[model samples]
Target chain A: MDLFIQLTLTGLTNGAILAMAALGFVLIFKASDVINFAQGEFLLIGAYVTFAMLAQLGLHWTLGLLLTLGVAVALGVAVERLVLRPMIGEPIISVIMVTIGLSSLLKALVSAIWGNQPKAFPPFIPSQPVKILGATVGEDRLWAIVIAIFMLGIFSVFFRRSREGIAMRAVADDQQAALSMGISVKKIFAWAWSIAAATAAIGGALVANIVGVGPELAGFGLRVFPVVILGGLDSIPGAIIGGVVIGLLEAYTGGYIGQGLNQVLPFIVLILILMIRPYGLFGQEIIERV
Target chain B: MLTLNNIEVIYNEVILVLKGMSLQVPEGKIVGLLGSNGAGKSTTLKAISGLLKPEDGEVTDGSIKFMGEAIHHKDAAEIVRMGIFQVMEGRRVFEHLTAEENLLAGGYTRRERDLSSDLEMVYSYFPRLKERRHQTAGYLSGGEQQMLAIGRALMAQPRLMLLDEPSLGLAPMLVLEIFGIIKRINQEQGTTILLVEQNANLTLGVADYAYIMENGRIVLEGYPEDLRQNADVREFYLGLTEVGQRKSYRDVKHYKRRKRWLS
Candidate 1:
């Protein structure tokens, strides 16, 4: 029972991180139909920005976090305008390739400035351990989980209740109809990209605290793809559930099944789920005619 | 209040979907566009709404003036902002949003005003939509989605409304109900409409002016009464038996009169 508890808690912690990242990924995809390959780079860039604000500028962690999210949003908008906007009417493959290229370009650029080395992340939450149900947990992990859930909750409200959110959803459903209804799809696209970037930034910074900040922070973007697919690409709840499931699977595999299996489980599950339910768990199924 | 003058749309520089299709919707009038399949009725609507670019022809070949100003080259978004909206052929409501949200999207351009009264008005036109306001639009039946689509457009407070086949995929009773609402909208709101329909009976019943399109061109044009009386239109559309039989105008007129009495 203790082992199960330990595994569950540990999995919940990791799931929280994946959930945050996957939320951003799904937001962009749901609103714009663009599979953003550069999402991981946004996370990595955000972490490095927070590092720069803290270490170089001597700013408080709180200020650095806010600055990081803001910069990340700006970066997202820039990328949408410079890369995604021009490729709007292009072939889907072309759009996907452009994002892939953008991610690589961002990686190279970040490495050039940050020197491709892992850096220590200072604890945003105090270095205190909290004992819950006879299991000890770090304050940062608790903070990370709390913040992740809060952010996701806030986003859920924004997507459900806000005018811009509804407008963004309209654009996603039918661009032409959206335009007819006086919804600016371009503006919605920018908002989706910016919001996704902001979420990624926070998720990256949180993950950096859990595992030391590094260029590999961006790699979480790729890891999120499977989670999103499992959840249902367009379904917000699916993203959260998919993230938690993947996180638990990873935790169990690392704890008992083996670390190698941990890496392979998500991919295997992703393929199987896609074959069975192409739309993801909560996603609307699409029927295509030849 | 709307005009499409010499609008030419070519697909890939080869397939001419619309060739010099000119049309007009006078202020506060419902203009019905009738056509067989592949007759470019929908394409003309698309061109007017700025969903397609006319590279092979010119809107300036004459001039497409809306409210006395040429709006031919304006973008779709800009055109919508100028109080022109389309209820597309399929009633493309946002599947994920509730009927109310779909209506809210119509008032996307109207940010400051309270939308409740407008909502109330839309409900008056489509009571079923009011009942299903909280339900996702995708779950609505075909007739309900049509009401939602029209309700959404009404929320935009358009000066000119373009309805593309409002009666498509509907039962005859629902068709009458939709046409009734459309007539009410024109009579009550005085919103000018350009209606594109495959159902000639419904079109003739609702429109003041009518245009008959064939092979990407307007083949016949007249007032609804004139169109109802035209021999060519009667022969082609009113109904013709394909057997080796010849019919005179008098016989066709008598048949139409009898049918009208029965209807």
Candidate 2:
């Protein structure tokens, strides 16, 4: 029972972080129909930039977090303006290829600046153990869960209730129709890119807070694919649930079944989902009434 | 309020769609532009609304002036902000969004933060939309989606509303219902409308003045009463032949194309 409790808490923490990362992926995909391959690189940049501020520059962690987010937003806007904007009206496959190129470029830039070694992250969220529900959990892990849920909640509300959020969704549904309504597709694309970056940065920061920042941190982003696939690609709630499910599965497999199989478990689920439910558990069915 | 002066549109630098299409829409009145398929009716509205840019269509010559300003250079959002909203053909509502959210999106350019009054105004115009407000717009019936599209236009509170075939793909009765509301929207809000449609009979019924076009140019223009009495309109558009009319198949083919008017 104690082992189960410990595994569940750890799983929830990882799931929350996965949810944060997938949130941005869904946003960009929903708004622009671009499958951003660089989303993982975004995580690397976020982790490295924050590490630079907190460790090398000796800035306070809060200020470091803010500056990292600012950098993320700028990165997002610049990418959309410079790379994606010109590709408008191009074949969707070509547009997707551009994103793959972008991921490579960003990854190269990060290593060029930060080097190939992992750096110990500044102790922002203390890793001191905490007791919760009769199970011991790392303090950073608990905070990660809290911060992830908070970020996800704010965005869920934003998309559901805010005017601009609704406009963004409208563009996702139909670009020409949204334009006719005076919703600028260009502006919405910019917003999607920027916000997606900000969320991924937060997710990156959370993961860094737990594990030290490194070039290998990008590998953490690859794990997000299973979450996004399990969740509907465009559904925010789906991302949240999928994150938790994948996280719990990973924790259980590692805790009980074995060590190596845990890492491979998400891919197995991804294959099962693709074969059984291509749209994901909560994805839109792509059916149009008229 | 809106005037297009000999505007020629070329798509992909070739495939000329609109050849010197010219028309004028006066303030506070309904102006109907009647044309068959491929006569550049939809393209004309796209030119006025600046939706042409997206489709690689350009207004290469002449100018479009709205409210006495040269607007040919402006884009769609700028034109919309200047108080001209277009209800695009085929009722292109955001399928995933709820009906109410689609309307809120139309209010994107409005200066005021509070939109309850505008939403209420739209609901008053189309009560059916308010009932289906929470329903996903894609799942709505064809007629209901058309209403939502028109309601979206109204949410913008546009001064000059350009409607492209509001009656397309609906029952005759629903078309009549939509036309009645359109006339009401114009009269009540003093919103000038440039209506482009192939339904000449219904358009002529609602329009104060009308223009008939063929091959991307206006072939006839007059008050509805005058256009209704025109022999060409009666024979071709209204399908009304005179008593003891002896029109042959050749005449029928000629009436369909009506190339004599181009001269």
Candidate 3:
């Protein structure tokens, strides 16, 4: 029972990290109908930037985190304008290929600059452990969970209340109509990319504090796919729920069930969900014309 | 006032859709362009709305002069801003937006200062839309979606309205109601209208002047009363010839287009 409890808490912490990365993917997909394969690279870049700020520049951890997010947001905007915009209305396969190619490029660039070594990220939270319901968890882990939940909440409000958010939703529904209504579809695409990049940066930073930062940070971007698929690609609430469910499953399986199911559990869930409801839990089912 | 002179449009450089189609709608009159499925009625409207550029079609060969200016060169959104609004055949309302949001988007070209009044006027036209203003457009019934599309177009405050098959997919009652509203808009707002319809019965009933198009060419043109009285038009075109042979107005375009063959 103690082992189960410990595993569950740890799983939840990891799930929170997955949710953060998934949020960025959802934003870009929703606004531009572009699957950003480079989303993972954004996370990796963000963590390195944060590490450099804190360790090399001697900035405070909190300040470093903020600066890292700002940089990520800028990177997102630059990518939209430079990479995504030129490929507008291109074949979906071509667009997907572009993003995958971009991911490879970013991974190579990161390795060239930072080398293939892991670095410690100083935790913004105090270096202490907390006991919760007889299970011990690190303060940084708890902070990761809390911060992830908070960011998701903030994003929900942005989607529900902000005019720009509604405009983005409108564009997602019908790009031509949205453009006809004078909503600059290009601007919405840029904003979506920026927000997604910013979220990935924060996710990267949080993961670095919990685990050592490395090129492997890019893996989290791909890891988010299961959560996003489970949650529904377009659903914000689904992302949170999907994240928690996957987290708990991973924890329980690793601790009790054992074997390899834990490693492939998310993929299994994603496949099942997709087969049953191709749009996932919250995805809008579209009827194609031809 | 709007005019389309010899606007030719080919879909893929091979499929000739609109072949030298020309039309004119005088200020504040309801003109009807009647045609069958492949006759290019919708394509003609699309050409005027700037959705498709003619590779082999040019306004100079036949020009589109709107309010005495060449508007064929203008963009669709620009033409919309110039007060030409199209209620596309399928009632393509933004499906995800609430009814009111759809209406708000319609007024995209309006000044921010004039939006509130425009909103009120649209509500006055379709009070049902006001009641369901918060409901997403997808949930609206077929008839309601058509109403919302028209109301949205009205929000643009167009001087000339291009209505493409407002009766399509609608029940008989809704079709009649729609035609009634079209007449009311013309009578009350004094807006000129170029209506395209595959339903010839409805077009002839509502139009001040009617043009019968077949194979992307205008085969007949006249006042509604004159077209109704024509013997050959009534028989072969209007589906009225089966009733009986009656003395009717003479065919003009048939005579004109076949001048060389006749002479």
Candidate 4:
């Protein structure tokens, strides 16, 4: 019972972080129909920038987080304006290739600036463990889960009630229809990028606190891909549910099945989901009739 | 008032579609643009509404002035802000949105205006839209979709509404019903309208003035009654033959080959 409770708490923490990362991926894909392969790089940059502010400059944790988010938003907007804007009408394959190329470029840039070695992430959250349902878990992991859920709740309300949020949904529904209704499709695209960056930054910072900052942080992007695919690329709620399911699967498999099995389980689930239900659990089935 | 002067349009910088087409739509009048398929009627509407640029098409020459100011360089959103809205061909509603939300989207440019009243006003015009206000627009029948499309446009409080092929693919009774509502919208709102259609009989019935276009240029222009009385227009557009004429196919082909409009 203790082992099961411990694994469940750990799974929840990891799932929360994965949900945050997948939220960014889903937002970009939903709004612009671009599979942003550079999403992981956004998280890497966020983690490193936050680490630099806190560890190197000895800034307060709150100030470091704010600065990291600011930089993330600016980076997102700049990337959209400079790289993605010109590729708007290009073929889908070319756009995907551009994003793939962007991911490599970002990884190389981060390595050049910070060096290839891993740097210790200074402890911002307290190191004490919290007892939950008779199972002790790291306080930072508990905090991360709370923060991720909080952000998800905020985004759900924003997408549901906010005027700009509805406009974004309208654009996703039909670009020409949105444009005809006087909604600026360009503005919505920029908003989507910025929002994705901001969420990824929070996820990155939290993950860096768990594991030391390094180029390996970019691997989180690859890991989150399966989560988003499992959830439904365009469904926000699906991201959360998929994240938790994958997290639990990993925790159980890693606990009992063997070493390295947790890492491989998500992809297996992804392939199975793709074959059985291509749209994911909650994705809207796109029906196109001639 | 809107005026197009010797405007020329080309697709992909080649293949000229509109060749020196010029027309004037006076304020507070419903002007019909009548043409057969491939005659550039829809292209003209697109040029006026500034939707041509996105399709790899551009108005290559001349100027379009809306309310006596040159608006040829403005984008679609900018033109919409200037109080001209186009109901695109084929009823392009946001299929995923409810009818009410679709109407709200029409008021996107005019965010400061009270939308609830406009929603009520739209419902008043098309009561069917009111009944299906909560239903997703994709599920609505063809005629209801057309009403929703027009109602969505009216929510913008447009000074000029450009409707393209409003009667296309609809049954005759539904076409008349929609046309009746179109006329009522113009009369009640005093909104100037530029209506494009291939349904000459119905268009002429409601239009205050009519322009007949062929091969991207205006071939004839007059009041509806004048066009209705003309023997050529009656025979070709209205499908009415001269008394006991029974013209042979050869004669009809010869007449088309050497049309007076071509001269």
Top lDDT prediction, candidate number? 2
- The prediction achieving the highest DockQ against the true structure is 2
Q: How would the candidate models be sorted by TM-score, starting from the highest?
A: 2, 4, 1, 3
For model 3, what is the C-alpha lDDT against the true structure? 0.81
Query: What is the C-alpha DockQ of each candidate?
Result: 0.44, 0.82, 0.25, 0.57
In model 3, pairs of residues that clash are B235-B241
Candidate 2 chain A minimal-lDDT segment of 10 residues:
A281-290
Off by over 4 Å in 1: A1-3, A287-290, B13-15, B53-62, B240-263
Off by over 4 Å in 4: A288-290, B243-257
Q: Residue A20's C-alpha lDDT in candidate 4? A: 90
lDDT of 1 by residue, A1-290 (tens): 66677778888888888888888888988888878888888888877887788777888988888888889889888988998888776776888788899889989999999888898877676747777887777777777678777876887888787778888888888887887777777789889999888888888877777776888788788789889999999878787888889989998888887779998999999999989998888897652212
lDDT of 1 by residue, B157-188 (tens): 89899999999989999999999999999989
Q: What digit string (tens of lDDT, one per residue) describes model 3 on residues B109-143?
A: 67664477877887887888888989988888888
The digit string of per-residue lDDT tens for model 4 on B154-256 reads 9889999999998978899999999999999999999999999999999999999999999988999999999999877887788777776787776677444
lDDT of 3 by residue, A1-290 (tens): 78878988898888888888888899888887778899899999988888888877989877887899889989988998898888877776788899999999999998998899998767766648899889899888888789889988998888765657766877787766555444567788889999999988888887877786899889877778899899989888778778888988988888888858888998899899989987888876673332
lDDT tens digits by residue: candidate 2, B93-112? 88889989988999999988
Error of 1 at B49 (Å): 1.3
Model 2, stretches more than 4 Å misplaced?
B243-259
lDDT of 2 at A5: 99
Q: Could you give me the TM-score of model 1 versus the true structure?
A: 0.90
Better of 3 and 4 by lDDT: 4
